[model samples]
Target: MKYISTRGKAPALNFEDVLLTGLASDGGLYVPETLPTFSAAEIGAMAAMDYPSLAQKIITPFVDGCIPDSDLAAIIADTYAEFRHSAVAPLVQLDHNQWVLELFHGPTLAFKDFALQLLGRLLDYVLERRQQKVVIMGATSGDTGSAAIEGCKRCSNIDIFILHPHQRVSEVQRRQMTTVVGDNIHNLAIEGNFDDCQAMVKASFANRAFLPEDRGLVAVNSINWARIMAQIVYYFYAAVALGAPARKTAFSVPTGNFGDIFAGYLAHNMGLPVERLVIATNRNDVLHRVLTTSSMRRQPLQHTLSPSMDITVSSNFERLLFDLYDRDGAAIADLLARFDEGEIAFSETAMARARSLFSSACVDDEQTCAQIAATWENCEYLLDPHSAIGVRAAMTAGIAADIPVVTLATAHPAKFPDAVKGAGLNEEVGLPLHLRDLFERPERCSVLPNDLAAVQSFMASNIRA
Candidate 1:
């Protein structure tokens, strides 16, 4: 299968190439040239497969030309070997129709681990073969920074730099990224919102001089197609447990970067029988408004208990827009420029289509805390702050009863033990045995200004020196 740039100007590439080159050269995202499909029988056959085997089957078609099945299989195996769970992403029945897919089972205690782990492995193999190196730079609201650092740290050929809002993430989230001590891993706590941090990461990519200096400059954010592909695995794992087309399932995703929900759409595209896709947001509901109506406007951001979802600007929304408008990157670039200037408008048709498949809801700080407490009472299930928003969205939207709705438990509740305790949910729910020491590590990170020029200068000087 070939991958084409959303902008329609860059050369088509196979999957391995897309993984190595995060963004298309035309300043656009890369999408599959053609989506692959499977019959119900083939989809059903997945039940007996292991995580690496299932991943090979799902991902091989996209990168078959670039990465032969032998190499691809090895990469898949190496990536999941580090995960703490026997079944990499496990599904649990929370109630009659509600299920939680636990995804924070890797070295990094967040859903981002499922993707970035594979990404780091893939980069190592590819760059080693090519006898080259890269510097991966990214921005994160919370989990992505820590996941990226954990994945790329100690790699001999690759250096990773991640920028996040200072004092923005939950204490555990901050400590996870800052605590890592690796020669190649660098974390910058910036004095700005996630949007500013994200913009800086994007600017480094857009700059012509930086591209030549670091030809391997890459991204580990959801903007990288590989990240989304890696994330789609759990949806399939959960659906098979719920009976799939044998039983059409739905999902409620607590969205921040918008990559997680977009992966569900990928599953649907790949012939998984899914009914509802509920997108749950905190006060940073820029996407909630867009899915409901044509006005994809961003207001001044709001912070909430769910610090991870405290994002007014969702960067992965650009990939969705590219698909919605039939790969029109010119139009997408126009819309993004408008959005930056605090100006965004969409057609009624686009809004209607988005709403047909997606339902959106926002949970405030009070509601988020309440949902955590209530879920524990109603189902004896403890939810993290991010998962609380998803439960609220699923309940309010009234998930299709005929279909079981899987609400993605994106992170371990133990990661936010403070919030869990505040909601009176500090019981002895078992965390993965390996991550028990997450809180005991000494954090080590650098603080930096929000200025774009300063960041660029730091990157250039450090790389050059």
Candidate 2:
């Protein structure tokens, strides 16, 4: 399948090319030229398949010509084998129709593992075949850094560099990325918020002259089409588990970069019968503001309990906007240019289309804590700060009682113990057995000022010859 840039200026590319080129040359995200659809019988048939088998079927069409089916299947099996849970993405019923899809069972203990694990393997496969070396630079609020590092650490042909806002992430989140012992895995603690780090990565992608001629730059960020494509599988997995197609399901996703929920949007387009998708956010709520007020503007980024969602500039939103504008790259580019200057009004048609499938809720720390406490007391379930926001959104979504609502549990509670304690929970949330020695592990990282030149120089000096 061919992929096209959201901004419309970049040349169309196949899946492997899109995987390597995270952000398009024209400063746009890549999306499939034509989305693959599954029939009701096909989706229903997935009910009997295991997680890896289901992944192969769902992802095969996107990577058909790029990777052979047998190779893709084996890669998928290897990717998910790292997950601790047998179900991989499992669902738990909270109420009659309310559920939480636990997605933190992977090596890094976050929903990002579902995509990053596969992404790392895909990159390794392509790079190995071409006998080339590339650099992977990504910006993470919290989870993506660790997940990406864990996913790609074993890739000898690639060097992975993850930049996260220093002192903003939780201790566990920081250490998860830092403690991994691999010469090829480097973490950068940028002295700014997530947007600054993300901007640096995007700018680096736009200007490649700083890097060596033979080396290519790749992205492990959600801007990469492969990450989004990998994410789309879980939506189908969760929906089918709840009886999809014949019975429509709704999802309340705790999203920051907009990648996760955008995957749900793709699933809907791919005929998954997603009835409604609630865009759940914490205090940094540009997406909610855009949906509610039609005022697509930036706000100062805030450090919240849900550090993962502490982003004012949702990068993946551009992909959705591209579609809302009917894939007019010029129009998307112009609109975003105005958005960069300040607030830009969305066309009534675009707003209407987005509002049709999406409902949004902006919850704060107070509500996040309350949801955590309430869920623990009522349902005997502990939720991380990000997942708490999702539960809040799902509870207030006002969907019909008969239709099931699944909140995507984005991370394990142990990843954010401070938030757990703040919620008045007395119980200790310990790291998984594998990460029990996380604090004892020596960390290797570079603390850099949020300056692009300095960051680039550091990379140039440190990258393997």
Candidate 3:
């Protein structure tokens, strides 16, 4: 399957190239040239399959010409074998039709593990075959850093660097990334917010003159097509388990970068009977504003209890906009260029198309805490602040009572003990057994000023020769 850039200028690429060459040459995200759709029988058949089997079925098409089926299957199996849960992405029912798809059971305890784990393995296979060495530079608000570090730490041919806003992420989140011990793994605590760190990563990808000529820069963030491709599996997994094909399933995703929900959008187009897609956000809600106001504008990034969603710019939204504008790369480039100036509004047709499939809600910290408290009281289910935002949004989504709505539990509640305590819950939220000693682990990280040159210099100096 060939992938094309959202902005029209970049050359069409196959899956492997898209995986490696994230953030297109023309500053766009890559999307499949044509999505592989499953027939009703095909989707229905997935009900009997296990998580890995369903993953192979859904992901095979994306990596068709790049990785052999056997190798892909092995990689997938090995990747998921590390997850703490047998179901991988399990669903827990809260009310009659309200469910939370638990996605934090992986090594790093976040939904990102679904993709990053597979991505690290894919990179290992591809780079080993080609005898190439690359560098990974990623910025995270909270979870992606630890997940990416965990995923890519073992890659022999790659050196991974992750940046997170200093003092913005939770203690668990910070420790999760910093505590991992590897010569190839480096974490940077930037002095600014998430947007600043993300900007540095994007700018560095756009121009890599600082890196060694032989080492290409790779993206671990959702901009990579492989990340999004890997994520599409759980949507099918959750939907099929909840009775899809004959019954439509709806999803409410707590997203900052828009990557996770974008995967759901891809699933809908790939023949999943999705009832509605809800965009659940915390205070830094660029996506929420877009769907509600039709204007995509930058705002000051806010630090809330749900630190993972503290983002001003939703990078993956451009992929959806590319489709909304009929895959007109030139138009997408122009719109984003205008967006760089200050703000940009979509055409009425584009807005109408987006609104047709998406409804959004922006929840503040108070509501996030309330949802956490309410869910604990109602069903004895503990929710992280990000998942709390999702559950609250799903509750208010006003979908029919009969149709099931599953909130994607993006992270384990143990990752944010501060949020749990803030919810007025006296019970301690202990870390998983794997991370029980997280606070006791000795962390190694560099505190860097929010400067691209400083980051690039550090990366260049630290890369293994």
Best prediction by lDDT: 3
Per-residue lDDT of 1-465 in model 3, one digit per residue for the tens?
888999988999998888899999999999999999999999999999999999999999998768889999999999999998999999999999999999999998999999999999999999999999999999999999998999998888999999999999999999999999999999999999999999999999988999998999999999999999999999999999988899999999999999999999999999999999999999998999999989999998788999999999999999999999999999999999999999898899999999898999999999999999999999899999999999999989999999999999999998888889989999788888988888899999999998889999999999987
Q: Write the per-residue lDDT of candidate 1 for residues 1-465, one digit (tens) a residue.
A: 788877778899877778877778877788788888888999899988888888998887766667678988988998899888889888877778888888878887789998998888888888888888788899988899988888887567887788999998887788888888877777888999888898887777777474445456888989899998888888888898778659888899999889999999889889998888999999889888887667777688787778789888787777778878877768887887787787688877677777777888988888888889998998787889898888888888887566788889888887777667777665865457765676788877778998988786666555522
Clash number for each model: 1, 0, 1
Total residue pair clashes for candidate 3: 1
Worst 10 residues of 3 by lDDT: 427-436
lDDT of 2: 0.92
Please give the RMSD to the true structure for each candidate, in Å. Answer: 1.9, 0.8, 0.7
After superposing candidate 1 on the true structure, give the runs of residues whose Cα lies further than 4 Å from its correct spot. Answer: 208-214, 426-432
What are the lDDT figures for the candidates, one per model?
A: 0.82, 0.92, 0.93
Every model's TM-score: 0.95, 0.99, 0.99
Candidate 2 residue 139 C-alpha distance from true site, Å: 0.7
